[model samples]
Target: MDENCDYIFKGYTPNFTLQEDDIRAIQALYGGKPSKSFSSPLSNSIETYQAVSKQMAPSVKSSNKNSALCLDPQFDAIITIDDDTYIFKGI
Candidate 1:
């Protein structure tokens, strides 16, 4: 992660339970401008973060595609949206 960066960039994708296109459709409905610090979400600038959910062992799969996972959480905050940008104000 960039230590100097105040905001992290990520795509709001499905939890792997739904089709990718469905997630994209939902995102489009909530469209807003990109933050000043980052490019629009539609840009290739969006990122994904992953972590090893299980310990590595002899029988366990160590390959990233098998062990890495990305979890999504719900957050509550005040959001300011304009035609081109959206900012989150959280406590």
Candidate 2:
């Protein structure tokens, strides 16, 4: 039981392990090979963000759209771009 528990914690069932057929069935259903790494979700988020930012760098640098700035009575300032408005409070 202890050995089986250890196997389960390490990410596989000892008695009911996946065969080649089971792996193929999973790939057919999911459309991609399963990842072998056991990385944390936070690391995955950072990796995804870095990849997206690299792809967006060129377009972001070439953008010429200007934002309009104005002071609000309640907030410190307001920045307007297209139909969106962002307010900065306190400072």
Model 2, residue 87: displacement in angstroms? 20
Q: What is the C-alpha lDDT of each candidate?
A: 0.44, 0.56
Judged by lDDT, which candidate is best? 2
lDDT of candidate 2 over 1-91, digit per residue (tens):
6642463223234687677887889989987754685767788787777677556554333333322111122454567779999866553
RMSD (Cα, Å) for all candidates, in order, is 17.1, 18.4
Q: Which ten residues in a row are the worst by lDDT in model 1?
A: 48-57
Q: Which parts of model 1 are misplaced by more than 4 Å?
A: 1-16, 32-91
